[model samples]
Target: MPKPGKHINHKGRNRRFTNPEELEEERRKEEEAKRWRQKRGEVSSEEEEEEDDEASGGSDSEDESSDDEEGKKAKGVSNLIEIENPNRVQKKNKKLTTLTVDVPPEKPQLSRREREEIEKQRAQAHYQKLHAEGKTDQARADLARLAIIKQQREEAQKRREADKKAKEDAVKAKTAQTQKALGKK
Candidate 1:
């Protein structure tokens, strides 16, 4: 093969890359070095320190105001205790009389769709039970009535859809004619 084409070694060039796992390890070491550089008081900005101080100061002010209010309330309760009669302490220790307010039972509310579904389920179960009890004639009659009702509902729905579509078509035609007359189409 013509002296191995000048004996050039491609494997020696790839030795720098060696294994795929070594590449991953090198990447992890780079990330760890960057994190340590950041931790050595070299990465945090002054604006971030200012934001931290502002947040801490806001919470401290809120806590001081709450402590002052609590102290004032405690002083007021102490004054009240000093002004009260000592002989009536037993009466004060007794629980205060509470008035019980009677409330009326709330009426349960059901949506129209929920009520319809519940009624439909109850009717289906009743019909199935009747059929299972060998009431074949009654079951057949109920099924026929249900079929008639379903057909009537489907016919009404179709009529409504047709009417709506016709209305929409008429509006679209009118708009198109107007646009054509205006020379905008």
Candidate 2:
């Protein structure tokens, strides 16, 4: 595949735009953009050119009628009025990108140390949340390991007690036999 030509530069070296489907795709995208602008009550470049023509004092009957209709349309809808429906799922409203200038930032209300402490707490919470996700499985494994170790220790303790008891009983028996042998009889 050859590279697409960048405007007038490298013309013969490129051949990607030669496909009919690519040209149609580009054309369709442009048409869709024009439709979107019109739906948003925006005047496209073509409309702008027509407006310029009317401003130049074109005596066309259709242009004059449209101008009169535009004035009537403006009077029908107030600029201060808006339809606010919080439940409606729609695209973002097209309005001026306004930002509040008088709103104070957190920097004025909070000290630097306080802000840092809050950030540290937030970071700790996030870390704890991530650790908790894997902690359940790790805790189960640790408990199983501790149970095995405890059982082993208990078994060893029992074995030591049994050996001690056997030694004590054997010594008692040997002493009894020795005492009997030392008797006057």
Candidate 3:
């Protein structure tokens, strides 16, 4: 804030603003003893110390001694203080090991022809594997079962043929009997 310029009255006398409370306090003190105790500041403690040193004409040794004695640090300045360029990124150490694996790319979608080919290959491979493991080899019990199934199929076919032949013979015999009756009439 800008300090107020020195005020000049019509009487050419300089005037300065003073606190009424302070004036009253001074008056009370003067009334008590006609005296007692006095006043102080804009310069900080550090600046004040520097001014004191300049005023005292003190030696370097005395300055050093004062510095050693006045080791009291300002409260919590360390926490508030920040290092320069805190937002700057730091370079990483190259010596550290890094793992990079080259994974296989995703399998492409197969077309209809390709899918059919793959299915055929899988069936052939499975058939070969079953034969190689002797799993496709028919056991004696399985052979007997197959033979019984064949025998049953053959018997059924023979029965169907016999029934068809019997139907044809009946049809032929009925036609012949009808022709003979017509001839007699």
Cα lDDT, all candidates: 0.72, 0.73, 0.70
Better lDDT candidate (1, 3): 1
* lDDT by residue (tens digit), candidate 3, 1-185: 45567653478667788899999998787545421211222224554455456667666646764674466344557647865787999897764347445768789999999999999999999987876665775544566788999999999999999999999999998988998989963
Q: TM-score, each model?
A: 0.29, 0.31, 0.27
Ranked by lDDT from best down, the candidates are: 2, 1, 3
* Model 2 backbone overlap count: 0
Candidate 1 global CA lDDT score? 0.72
What would the per-residue lDDT of candidate 1 be over residues 1-185, giving only the tens digit for each residue?
55977877687664554688988899799668656855663433433344345667655655655554455323236755667676773634444455344767787899999999999999999888989775879878877899999999999999999999999999999999999999998
**Model 1 error, position 73 (Å):** 99
By TM-score, the better pick of 1 and 2 is 2
What is the model-wide C-alpha lDDT for candidate 3? 0.70
> How well is each residue in 67-139 modelled by candidate 2, as lDDT tens digits?
6456532434565587688998888765555766677767557888999999999998876776566465665
Specify the highest-TM-score model's number.
2
Name the weakest run of 10 consecutive residues (lDDT summed) in model 3: 34-43
| Model 3: lDDT of residue 108 | 100
